[model samples]
Target: MTIPQEAIEAGAQTLFEESQELDQDNSWDDELPEEWREAWRYAAQSALTAALPALERQIREQVAQEVEELKLNPKDSTTPHCVEEYNAGLTNAAKIARGKDQA
Candidate 1:
């Protein structure tokens, strides 16, 4: 079967960029078509799939920093649960408005 070179290259790139090494004896060297292999290599180095988890972790850390800053604000009067309460209230209102409430 013919495979696009883009797929193999992408895969290889992703794997290498992630600092991952191939198992010379067991990796997808001779199994997949040449184009597919190239695309895969490309994916290894350039695809976002490999970096998604790392990026997500970074985002979470940033959000945590913002939360910490909010907690440190001396003039803030709201408790940490304040946002949770507001969200719950809004959810209840939406449910009632949609005629899902028993009462």
Candidate 2:
């Protein structure tokens, strides 16, 4: 399965953001040796690198599930809303599957 560059970038950004939050005081990693911190950072980045494809797949599956749910709930008076949501989810899922950005 081809994972989108956008998804990879997003995953990396998320990691970075979370790390930033964890280090809000700018000293969260200060207790560790510099080399150890470097190694830990490398490991974290490597993990993110390895997990991006699976993450993309998870996103696709979740979108598909949402679309299916919307389809199954057509009995409600919000048919138009459900249809719109289903279409949007399906479209986003297709885009992710194809390694493309949402339209």
Candidate 3:
């Protein structure tokens, strides 16, 4: 199944911003260690990788519950569909971790 462009962009934005935060020291004048910054960036990126879909799942579940409460259809497909999306994220994360070209 195709994921939304907004979701991909949002995930990329979150990963980049968090990586930047991990690499910066606002209180400092000199640059951070190159090695350390790279390491931290990848670490934060991976953590975001694992977290984004899980976070999305929890949020989707809560919203689904709310919709069920109101006897309305939820915003998503079935649980298996959501799991497929989550697995896709995990697969993409692995590709990224391997430095594979997405194209």
Candidate 4:
């Protein structure tokens, strides 16, 4: 089938106008080929999927190791230090309140 020149010109003009609009909008991603975008997305997703389990396992192992170390040396744990500080503060506050009541 023979295509008319007017139809070809119209199609070309439409493409040119769309390209100009895309350029004005300044979206560089729109210029990338669809296949390239799809492949990049797939690779990124695959990498994340592959790495997530190892990342999670590493985090869990580190936490468990820290917990075990804390158990082995409870004197170095922040929890005991915080509890002692809180208790001391409470005792001081009680003494201050009692002194005010007496006054």
Candidate 5:
């Protein structure tokens, strides 16, 4: 199945929002000086912000690759059920046409 662009955007937005929330209320690095911890947080946030585009691109590429693989080798559950129904409809139409022609 193709991953919708909206889903990808939501995933990326979640990552960015979570990253923003990091170190907001918790002190995880007790060993480090307060200044060091603050600096580390700043650097981490900046790195994540700068890398957001690349991260989104990677997510898109990975999803596309998985979708292509599924298309090439779909499992029984993933196979289209509508194809059989469509074929059956065509057969019914042909039979009706044949009956009309004979009449």
Candidate 6:
């Protein structure tokens, strides 16, 4: 299944923001010049952008593997009750990954 672009962006943005917060909370960052901080952020964003495709591929592969295992040995009474439930599961997973949902 193709993950939504919005979900991917949200996850990436969350990660970037957390990194920034960590940097800010570090006492060493206070001595750093604004230029240096900006450069670090730029490099971080660039690295994340470059890694997105591989990250997405890995997520997809893992999800597919889990789905296959479920098909082979499903614990639920049904594979999925309906398409809406399946979509909800995907949406909920995205939310949890993005730190927008507790469960």
TM-score of each: 0.29, 0.43, 0.35, 0.35, 0.40, 0.43
Positional deviation of residue 42's Cα in model 3 after best superposition, in angstroms: 0.8
Q: Write the per-residue lDDT of candidate 3 for residues 14-103, one digit (tens) a residue.
A: 555665688943322246466644554565556566676767666656654443343322245466666566656555554444445552
RMSD of each: 11.3, 9.2, 14.1, 22.4, 15.8, 11.5
lDDT scores in order: 0.52, 0.61, 0.53, 0.50, 0.49, 0.56
Kindly give the stretch of ten consecutive residues in candidate 5 with the minimal lDDT sum: 67-76
Off by over 4 Å in 6: 1-27, 72-103
Q: Per-residue lDDT for 1-103 in model 5, tens only?
A: 3344554444444544565577354333235366744555555555566777776666656654543343321234454566445545554544443332311
Backbone atom clashes (below 3 Å) for every candidate: 37, 0, 0, 0, 0, 0
Give every collision pair in model 6.
Answer: none
Worst 10 residues of 6 by lDDT: 68-77
Sort the predicted structures by lDDT, highest score first.
2, 6, 3, 1, 4, 5
Q: Show model 4 residue runs off by greater than 4 Å.
A: 1-30, 72-103
**Which stretches of candidate 2 lie above 4 Å from their native place?**
1-30, 72-103
Tens-place lDDT digits, model 6, residues 18-85: 77676745433257576655565555566667777888677766665554343322245466456446
RMSD in Å for model 6? 11.5
Model 2 clash pairs are none
Q: Tens digits of per-residue lDDT for model 2 on 1-103?
A: 4455555555545555577687754343356466645554555567776886887778777765654554434355466687667767776776665556777
Decoy 3 TM-score against native: 0.35
Which regions of candidate 3 fall more than 4 Å away from where they truly are? 1-30, 72-103
